[model samples]
Target: MDGIIVRRVIPSDNSCLFNAVGYVMDHDKNKAPELRQVIAATVASDPVKYSEAFLGKPNEEYFSWIQDSEKWGVVLTWLLLFYSEGAIELSILADYYGREIAAYDIQTTRCDLYGQEKKYSERVMLIYDGLHYDALAMSPFEGAPEEFDQTIFAVRKDRTIGPAEGLAHNFVKEQQRKRSYTDTANFTLRCGVCQIGVIGQKEAVEHAQATGHANFQEYR
Candidate 1:
């Protein structure tokens, strides 16, 4: 397909960000643990670079927290349950791979480029719909299998950013028109365990604290 870009949806298993990065960088979807370890090791190696003020926690604490993958059933369940990857993880992985990582935000239709000033020669892309992350790739044709996807593009050739931004805007706008995202702030949710209703993440968290219900299904 001529300039066809596609959003490859990664599983929303709390490791979606890592999985998307893995897919773009190595064409692998299961490198979350390995990537998490990389972030932890990088942070540990340079405490001064990744300080308490920068990480919003002590360097050691941030590293430890990033590496732990325990789910909601554990004691630190609340933190783990709501943990979503942001700038910190992106910067670490971008430097580790020596490639610029561009995250196209659907809500704002803006590109957040990590390693933007590093003069990386290659670039990879991801689509962010507020809560989840998905890889952006150039497919050989429309509806092509992901096995045939081309993710990494040459920055020197100008093969990545401009084209990706245009296609991403189209994709993001279509998704917006379809209402394919959760507002998180105002969306209604029903507790999957007890079928009780709650509004927004705040209410859901409060309900979880009072009733020990962790499973929730978003609804209209």
Candidate 2:
């Protein structure tokens, strides 16, 4: 591995994926909207190729939804990787969901709409934590760059530091405590059918059963 440094992008309004991609491409965060449009257009043009199984919605509807500044998921991940490969002519290695870093190679069996094959010769890396994204850049270190298996490094189980583990544990505990407190607090459920506010789960359930209003949203 070379002295590859991971850079964090500033948190945006749930636009981490866009920010991360922009940072890696040496572009401003504003590029996210354009990138989203590109991806939407690509999917829209060839709905059969990038079908509902990957897009998670009807093609046009999903395209409109993804254009908004929101958190992206696996669908956008693959779309962005494919788009970047074509745009920049680089194979991208994405560290996804803190589980695995997979490489998307454009120089592979990627067939285009016209059934044309294209190939790229460069590679880059991006990091994802199932919530946010970041970029990784490699530069000259003090010593020589050591060759290592990227697959092993990507899913290494022993990579978590002790302090990181402790902090993660504490964070989970805190979240649990907060959830418990919230659960105990008074909650109002608004029925989707009748639009009536019912207090408490028991009352809400009873109301739903009585009125056949199965849909509800919780309010504090």
Candidate 3:
């Protein structure tokens, strides 16, 4: 309760979610491939649970798509170019690791718990700023090294969530004040494959669908 909780930034190599989750789960940021395999295995082991209706695509497609390190996106109502994970992945991970994953959204300042109803003994925190995921950890003192930070907390530790939520609120507020998140609805993007300019998320989706180009880069 007396520790300083800080946001641990993760790389934006299109695997930030997995890396952040890995950091919070194991203090290892390079566990993306293993974690992806875990998700694939979990899904494969439960075809009925991770069916087309739940996965938004055929089970086989999602299995390969998630395993492919070069591929991304979760196929929500709309698609972003570099999305690595979503609620579905979070749920799978929660079950796989037997820990609740609390994701605090910077845009909405809402904490979404992946394994809320489950009986998990531990919980890990992640920060979501619309497009990227970062980890939250508690350090023993100010400016302490990351090696001393604690990323996982006991589920019954009522003190942990309070500080985590406070820090998340302040951090998200500051980020919002600076307009730090990409406005997917209105952000300008250029197709990396064909070098065609696209406006907004809808236009980007249309361009990708029409031209079969999945690569896109944001441009102001």
Candidate 4:
């Protein structure tokens, strides 16, 4: 996809997107109001985008980023209205770029570029307050994937063991430990649902075959 920057305008920014948004605002003093209306209408048409951008995310994928663009547009337009009040006039964000950069007064004032390991680009913010603090930059991926659990299938893939022999220990002791003693794929299943790569399918079939014979007994 083509690379594009999304940001608010601020003092001394020299970036293309910053200047473009700032120029638009300067030409039409009421452009902020119009931008807001456009944003509201656009957002109304696509609520998913608004929600994804404002909130952390619906998921860790590009679709979420694209959906959030609508809300980003709304914030950008709203920020332009603050030019008179010295509020952050713009925030520059590039969805395609591995890194993100922002500017003040048409100049690249602040830039955040990570090492090659970064999966996605960062967000650039604008601050118009006279206090001279840095424009707030927040990473969406931060504090994500807090909960990582393995399923029953995952265990079998990790360790070369079948459910029957492997389950002997558990059946004898009937102990349940819900912690990752090994890697994500190797950990023992805490329960039936959590069994995975470690447990072979043959064991299950053999057990069923041995136990089969219609053992159903109805109580009167």
Model 4 has how many clashing residue pairs? 37
Alpha-carbon TM-score of each model against the true structure: 0.77, 0.43, 0.85, 0.22
Local distance difference test scores for all models: 0.77, 0.42, 0.77, 0.26
lDDT of 3 by residue, 1-220 (tens): 5677688999877778888999999999988899899999989889999888777668998899888776553233134333333888888889889999988776667778888778687889898876678898888888989999888877664534555557656777776677766666777778777889887777877877788676777777
**Tens-digit lDDT string for candidate 4 (1-220):** 1111222223332222333332322321123334333333444455565454442233233233323323332122222222321221221122222232222221222222222133332322232221121222222233322122111111133322233223323322221133211121222221122222222223322332454321111111
Candidate 3, RMSD to the unseen true structure: 3.1
The TM-score of candidate 1 is 0.77
Q: Which stretches of candidate 4 lie over 4 Å from their true place?
A: 1-22, 52-102, 105-108, 111-127, 130-220
Off by over 4 Å in 3: 73-85, 157-160, 209-212
- Model 1 regions more than 4 Å off: 71-85, 156-162, 188-220
Q: At residue 135, what lDDT does model 1 achieve?
A: 93
lDDT of 4 at 4: 16
Per-residue lDDT of candidate 2, residues 89-182 (tens digit): 1111121112222221222212121101222222234443322444433334433232221212221234332232233234334434444222
Question: What is the Å distance of residue 34 in model 2 from its true position?
Answer: 0.7
RMSD of 2: 13.1
Candidate 3: residue 123 Cα off by (Å): 1.3
